[model samples]
Target: MAKAFASQGDLTEKEISFTEIGEGLYAFTAEGDPNSGVIIGDDSVMIVEAQATPRLARKVIDCVRSVTDKPISHVVLTHYHAVRVLGASAFGASQVVMSEKARSMVVERGQEDWDSEFDRFPRLFQGHEEIPGLTWPTTTFEGRMSIYLGNRRVDLMQPGRAHTAGDIVVYVPDQNVMFTGDIVEYHSACYCGDGHFHDWPRTLEAIRRFDLDAIAPGRGDALVGRDMVNAALDLTGDFIRSTYRPAARVALRGGSLKDAWDAVRAECDPKFSDYAIYEHCLPFNVARAYDEARDIDTPRIWTAQRDKDMWEALQG
Candidate 1:
């Protein structure tokens, strides 16, 4: 019998946690589901990584309303993933920001990604019809952009490509808190369907240079305190290496994609099988790793058709 398609079978709603990890900083995490980071300034609020849809994002908005009356003035897109950006309209932010590379990705494949992801994870896109359309950024920066909310400073930087070609991190120097999108997940599978495996470690290294007191990752729980933050970062780096290395080795040896998948499972299952979305991500992650290992520089676009074919080929 064929396995359930992607996350189509995952319909259970997770318990949400809205926690303040630092001064006026909040993380909206749902028990291993996608997360969003909230940064409250003196006058306004800045949200990092919008939820999957406007209806789903409203829950996050409700959480924000519970804390402050400040209007959301900035919506930051860490990358151009549907689960992260399609909810931009819910924020009503004056400025929607993302890296130039990320913006380009949205222009190139935003619609395809939207369609592909909705089919892959129906549960995440519960209010799919409510999504106005493709999410476009009002501002696009190259390397770094500094945003000042009254006196509080928030720095947005694209360290390097990891989760996507334009993955960005939100850093608050004053609080020493960072919001790393899918670049570094905590106890959650890093979706590598559009990742840069060879460059992910380098990107992770760049993030390590910061003295982080806390980190709000793309998924899983928020990490507070320096020790826990460091551990989370280290674990994320380890996960990236472990997932890609074996598949990469197999690919380099001219093995079949199945061989690469088998290699990855042998190496990762023992340690990461219990992680959220581990099973859902393995096929896609292995496919990307195999491509990167064989020196495929740019990640191939994942259309709905491609997602189905890849799943059946590997997990069927």
Candidate 2:
């Protein structure tokens, strides 16, 4: 290979922040690393997203302990991404829940994704040895489901296909706050390797229609007000559009993958170069955008070998 993946060189640890976005609702963010959300109810707690490893999940546990001693009754996964679901065992929650489609994805490509992501981002998997195996959900829902932690209604819904076909958002209606997975990122780059480029903007609009007061985004900081929530939504939509437009144009015109890459860069680099993981996500985003534009509805599974081949073809 000519050079390593961008995430391979990102070994520096980011500063962690546990910010309260709403009453009993917190966002555990590590700069541009994967973020998690916490919701405390009358008797128990619910976790929105788990980190990549048990060692990483402990940080979220520590933060949860700081504010409340209630037991974690449920762990709600936003999607089937390895970085977000592999750390579930550490929570020791009685109920681990996911969308039915997401569970199917876990059965299909979970192991491949875990291997792919582990190789692509080594620093995120600090405790790979502790992982028993692939994580599975104890409960699965079709489209939407609501759980009550002692009268606190928590709604989990899949607005539409965006980051993935099964992506869901965790909404606490009482607080008017939502925990959007990779569907909505704050200042970080959206990893579109498993995305629906054409359906993403409509998903963004679906989220925006709620007029949320606050949101704990997939990456970056906690949005604590309507203004910040809207800003994140708008910025995330812009990121998706900026990445897909040029690549789609290139692909429809019968351009090569390298040609699509350059076209995407010319359009995205000026606006998104400084975004976290921008360089790391660009190639895969371009390739996926190109594929989707060429009428590939479902994203190809990203195995470790596929990751290498793609990186070598684009980055080598």
Candidate 3:
């Protein structure tokens, strides 16, 4: 028997948890599901990573209402993935913030990404109809910017590129808590379909410079305390390096794509087999790694049709 197409086989709903890592920082995570971070300042709130649709976003809003009454003033997008950005409308945030690179990526491939992601994981797109099309950023910065919500400071920085060409991290310097969106996944498998393999570790090194007491990664439970934070960062780095090393070696040797795919699975599965979305992400991750190893700087745009084709070739 063959495996089901990407995430199509995943039907189980994950249990959600809202953990307070700091006085005003919360991590909204669903057992390995895509996570969201909530940052509450003295007067306003900022959401890091919107859910897939407005209907799905309401659940986060409910979570937000449970804690703070401060109006959501901003929605910060770490990167331009449909699952993370399409739910912006539900927050009614006055400003949607992102990096200039992220905005450009959205303008270039947001629609195709929307269709590609929806088809790959329909369960996450439960409120597909409620999406008001592509989520656009109201404010964009070139490198890094500090946002003050009534005196409390939050720094948003583009620490090079990892998961995507325009990945960003939300750092609260005083709280020592960072919301690392997709740049560092916890137990969840790192989705590298749109990633840059070589630059990823350099970006991770950039993130490590922060004096973080806690971290809320793109997926999985939030890590609190320095030891746990370091462990999570190490795990994310290990996953990325393990997946890319073997695949890249095969690609550099002029091996077939199948060889690269096999190399990644052989190298990565032994360690990451229990990680969430490992199976679903392997083929796409290997494909991207292969391209990167072959000197392809830019990631290919993923469309619904391209998704099916790649799955059929590598995972079918």
Pick the lDDT winner. 2
Model 2 residue 144 lDDT?
Answer: 91
Per-residue C-alpha lDDT of model 3 across residues 72-171, encoded as one tens digit per residue: 9999999999999999999999999999999999999999999999988889998698888899999999889999999899999988989999999999
The TM-score obtained by model 1 is 0.99
Computed on alpha carbons, the lDDT of every model, listed in order, comes to 0.92, 0.93, 0.92
Identify the runs in model 2 with alpha carbons over 4 angstroms from their true place. Answer: none
Model 2 agreement with the true structure over 1-316: per-residue lDDT tens digits: 4766759988999999999999999999999999999999999999999889988999999999999999999999999999998899999999999999999999899999999999988999987899888889999998899999999999999999999999999999999999999999988999999999999999999999999999999999999888998899899999999999999899999999999999999999999899999989988999999999999999999999988888888888
Compute each candidate's TM-score over C-alphas: 0.99, 0.99, 0.99
lDDT of 1 by residue, 163-200 (tens): 99998999999999999999988899889989998889
Q: Report each candidate's C-alpha RMSD, comma-separated, in the order given.
A: 0.8, 0.9, 0.8
lDDT of 2: 0.93
- Candidate 3 Cα errors over 4 Å, as ranges: none
Which of the predicted structures, 1 or 2, would earn the higher lDDT when compared with the native? 2
